[model samples]
Target: MKKVLPFVLLLVAVVLALVFPSVEPVTVADATFDTGDTAWMLVSTALVLLMTPGLAYFYGGMVRKKNVISTMLQSLVCMGLITVLWVIFGFSLAFGEDIGGLIGNPATFFMMKGMLGNQAWPLAPTIPLVLFAMFQLKFAVITPALITGAFAERIRFNSYLIFLCLFMIVIYVPLAHATWHPEGILFQKGVLDFAGGTVVHMSAGWAALASALFLKKRTTPAHTPARVSYVILGTGLLWFGWFGFNAGSAVGAGALAATALATTTTASAAAAMAWIFFDIFRGKKPSAMGACIGAVVGLVAITPAAGFVTVPHSLVIGVVAAVISNLVVLWRTRTNIDDTLDVFPCHGVGGMVGMLLTGVFAHQNVNAGNTTGNGLFYGETKLFLTHLVALVVVSVFAFVGSYILLVITNAISPLRVSAEDEEAGLDLSQHDEEL
Candidate 1:
């Protein structure tokens, strides 16, 4: 009892922090800007930033110990590489003025003209354009990083770098523009991705599937199975960062942000429970991997609906997403296709489920003007159909583009290492270091 008291007290404090209302309102008039919103976004950006490293650990622990450092480096290196690319041209191509409804112009390259003197873009107010750019930088970094997991333990470092550059230019930027920009085709068509369900998760997940197919399989089975403790720690960090990823999408410190936060938490919890229950029903003990994967599925599913769905509706979305993604992972393992880290199953399947459910559960009372006033149960099924269209289009584009890029990359240099290098492990063979 004595040993557990400290942990109990810490948990109580966290609960109070979450539930307790602030007596004083933190507003912009009280400072240089909307301090409350700025503070929240800043914190959110940092939280989202942490997820890349969390991804590193998550992917790292899944590979053989000899290749752990190399696998982890793929994610960590993207943090630096993508940040520069975003500032240089990635952001402009995604968020700048539309060009023929297909892509954004390079009007804001280097964020030169638009970022002067705390200038605000039309898309988000209260926060500076620089803050918005940095917030998005985290997303740009993680999408390609997610693909690293699919090709883990075998990809050449130089080829991986080349692949990231191509992915950012050819696949990620256009998808991000289509989903996130106000004048984007999907946005114009009324797709309701509050954060990045289609743009980030689906794009990365499908690309992961393509990469896994193109790369074939690792030459060696993992000498050391994934470490459960590392998986748990990575999951915890991802959960913490996801609050920023979802809630920050609201771009304000208001009721919408609160709604997003609530929905995010509810969905994650519900999915975790559902996954555990499913494991028990299958005659297997609940696993840390199941909990981690379930939490991620919930996060992915809610990304498009975080600000639109009610708490209870979000719970349903999470539960259903977990079941679908779990089944998809199981089905994929039965095939020869080796999605090394199940990225397609969790993110791709969860994104599709969430997108459809968002249509079913979306209510006018929540975030109004969401195409349909009432949900599917309320006799409005157009939203559901629209979601299905978005999923199919995004999936096709991602898979096809990724496949072409992989073929091009293979022509330039081998995508996978030699069998001897694979046996020695990527960390030593590619980086000249033993884990």
Candidate 2:
């Protein structure tokens, strides 16, 4: 039953996709698709998709040898599972017609019935609607994969599988719709998220914190990281893929994309340096894990502000995020909570820093997206205040929503592995495989 469960679920999803009625195609107006933009989006989608395997390696290297395969699979399986979900109804819930400002009308694009090559997505006028959906699909795939780091090696495989579907449907879809869709409540309120500072990093980070608190500490003794080299390689890939992640949000092969790419590189490099220097000041040798985590935190910090902030602003954001996340990781180590891989400190805190700083440093000269208001440093208060409110709202929603999902999944199937499974390790116990 365990072996066939995924196949069964996948078959069901396929049947549903085939049976759902395809609504009549909407008449597209005079919008013309740009071949240049379409080409860039195609490349960008592939780059974003690469991040998941990179993530698998990144998370895999941090677990014990006995759990590496399971740890990696947690990240890898999302590529398969979320794709099916997205094709069925996930995209509809995210990018379908607005529903009361909180969600999309699932019927708007049910089963991707109306998302055809001829249709142009209103949000991205220059690209094909199909390409837009595919780009967004990559983002959906990676969000839940990020949460797996918090509970790594100790979660039941079946429970994690169940939680993945629930998280995407109940948490991610609404948040994405609310923040990115044109009529979304936050979007209407003039919130500025160039990429997914609030939708992706913040949601994943807060949920990770909740997972750690709910799961409690691991029963088994801690082990050293299985492979630092793998961590470094994964970091390199994530760094590479992030260019596509942030820049691609422009939805066009234009100057904005170029600016975003530049800022991403600067921020990541700045954060990596800051982390290593901070570690050295603490009397510890420079560590590969620290550098990788710091780089990723920087990437998270710049995601929301990539298009609106200048290159110099990105440097400051990276330095600040690195220091703050490093401190939080240190603080967390002293507490009873075992967050396995510090997902919350690095992603959650880093995302908050980015959102707030974007409110402070945003400049209209940098990009045309800042039509609403600039940051606090630019003598404007509205954007900063709005970001603060958003931070509170999103944090509460992600934490509370995720906790409820965890509880529900636990009720259906125990979330934690048995003590015997823990001793034997997740790779062998859960999947009957060993590294």
Candidate 3:
């Protein structure tokens, strides 16, 4: 009762404010005024902003120390490159007025047409257009960064810059519009991606797979592949930032955001346990790296469903995702594909798992007017079928599109470095410095 008193009082205040509105409602006069929703979004954007650097460290630690800086730079560089493109035309191409259900018109290039004061393209009522842009910027910053993990230790720096430019315009923008735009085919068809299971994770995962196939593997295995400390630190940062990634998707300081926060935490915890158990069963002690990776998989799995499912459902989803991703990673290594950082296993498998489970676990009670109606427990199976269709379409498009892009990139310039460069390592050969 003591703990419940504060919540009770808060609820009363909300109800009173809604019921007995003031004669003149307060308005945020400043475009950047610190309203509750705006404040939350600002913090959320910062959290997601941290993830790019965190991803750099995560991939950096996985590669040999000789190539650590080079590997990390791949992610870091995308932050700047993608942000510039996004401001120029990427946002307009993605979130501008829809054109015949295909793509957004480029009417907002350079943010020229819509001034800072314009609310025409606002994502959240309380947050300014610029704030929304910055939030989405974080998403754009991370997707290409995820791909660097796949072709790490290979791939020329010049070609990579070209690839990112092409990818942001051709791939990420279209997909973001397809899933997120108000009139998007998937969104109109009742697909329930609360965050970016399809848009970000699935797309990045498939692209990573294509990159691995095109780039080929390192000629020799890493001399010392273990960087447990760096991996652990990177994982910790990712976990912290993911709260914004999932909860911030709600776009408001409301009940939905609170629910998303709870589910995200629960799923991550469950996945961590599941990974540790799998390691124990495999006759190895679960290392900190394994546990951290498992937690990330769980978080990814629940990303699309964070605001749609109950906390208990998120736990189940996370555990299942961790187990499946762990097995997939192990199985991929047995083949010659050489997905350097297991992107296909972690993000690809986890995204697929989350998309499907979203259909099973999504409940209308959580968010009224949710298009799916009810969850499996509530006797709705149609949503599950729709999820399957979305998964297949996204997977096929991402994989095929990425493969073609890689082929084109390779044709323009050699994708991998020369044999001498490969032997000497990217840090020394490409950057002229060694970590």
Candidate 4:
């Protein structure tokens, strides 16, 4: 019944897709469109999409050789699975007509009904609405992929898929709507998440923590990474693609984008340096993995403040985030919770630091569009306090919601591989293949 039910539902969706083709009247380039902005957005969308494959490599290299293929597939699968869901109604659920200041109406853009025209999202007026939606689709794709790092090596493939879908519906969509939707509760309260410190990183990070807690520890916890070179390559790709993730959030190829790009570069560099140096100071050899992870933490830390803070302040954000996350990683090692790859410490804590620092370093001089008053550094308490409260709320919601979803998924599909399967390795046991 379980296997048949999935096939049946997919058949229904297939029938529906064929029945409802997106044959809306297409409009060629309209006068309202700026070629530069549109061109940049097109490039930006492609760049962000590349990050998922990059993530696959990043996570794949960290697991044992037996689980390498399984781990990589988890990240790659989101590209196929989430994109279909996004095109159907996921976009509307995150960006459609406001629903009581909490969510978007799922039917607002059913099957992208009205997207073929010269329409533009209110926030991104230069590009077609469809372009904006596609850009956001990349973000949606990579988020659940981020959580994969925590539960890597032990999760059932089918159960992971179910949990991924449940996560998007219950966790990612609501947070996206609440933070990015103009009328969203958080947005209205002046939460200035320039990219996705709160939306993408924080949500994925807390969910990773929840998954680590719920899944407990692996049966064979002692293992070494399969390929450090793959991790390095993945980090390079992620760093390159992140230019689009942060700078492209400006939604235009203007000064703001340039500012974001500069800040992203500086923050990441500073973080890499800090991470390796901090390790050396601790009498540990400065390793390539440390450098790559540090760079990513920097990237995560500066995501929310990229467009809103100066380059120097971005350096501060990066260094502070790296040091803090390193400490948390050290602490996690001392505890019983095996967060497989320390997703919570690096992404979760890095995101929290970024969000709070944005409240401290953001200023109108950098981006006059900030109606939210100056940050704490400029003697404003409102912004910082608002972020503090939002941080707690987001933490609780993501952790609790993800834990519940894990329980439900376990009931349906059994979240873990069997003991024999675990011994055989997920690649051979689950996929009938081996690296």
Model 3: per-residue Cα lDDT over 252-341, one tens digit each? 889999999999999999999999999999998978878988998998999999999999999999999999999999899888888888
The digit string of per-residue lDDT tens for model 1 on 1-435 reads 534643664475456445542333223332245788888889989989999999888778777787888988999999987876676668889888888656888765433334645555566777877788889889999989988878887788877877887899889889888877878898887788888888888888888999999989776543464576777888888888989999988887888989999999999999988998998888889988888889888998998889888998999999999988988988988988778888999887788788888888888788864654556856887777777788889889999999999999888767899999988878889988875
Candidate closest to the true structure, highest lDDT: 4
Candidate lDDT values, in order? 0.82, 0.91, 0.84, 0.92
Error of 4 at 114 (Å): 0.8
Task: Please identify which of the two predictions, 1 or 4, would achieve the higher lDDT against the true structure.
Answer: 4
Ordered list by TM-score, greatest first? 4, 2, 3, 1
Which regions of candidate 3 fall more than 4 Å away from where they truly are? 1-34, 118-123
Could you give candidate 4's per-residue lDDT for residues 147-254 as a string of tens digits?
999988888998898998999999998999999999999999998999899999999999999999998899978789999999999999999999999999999999
Q: How accurate is candidate 3 locally (lDDT)?
A: 0.84
How many residue pairs clash in each candidate at the backbone level? 1, 2, 0, 0
Candidate 1 clash total?
A: 1
lDDT of 3 at 275: 98
Which model scores highest in TM-score?
A: 4
Give lDDT tens digits, candidate 2, residues 85-126.
Answer: 898888999989899988988777677787654688887988
Better of 2 and 3 by lDDT: 2
Residue clash pairs of candidate 2: 359-375, 360-376
What local lDDT score does residue 289 receive in model 1, on the 0 to 100 scale? 82
User: Candidate 3 at residue 24, lDDT?
Assistant: 35
- Total backbone clashes of model 3? 0
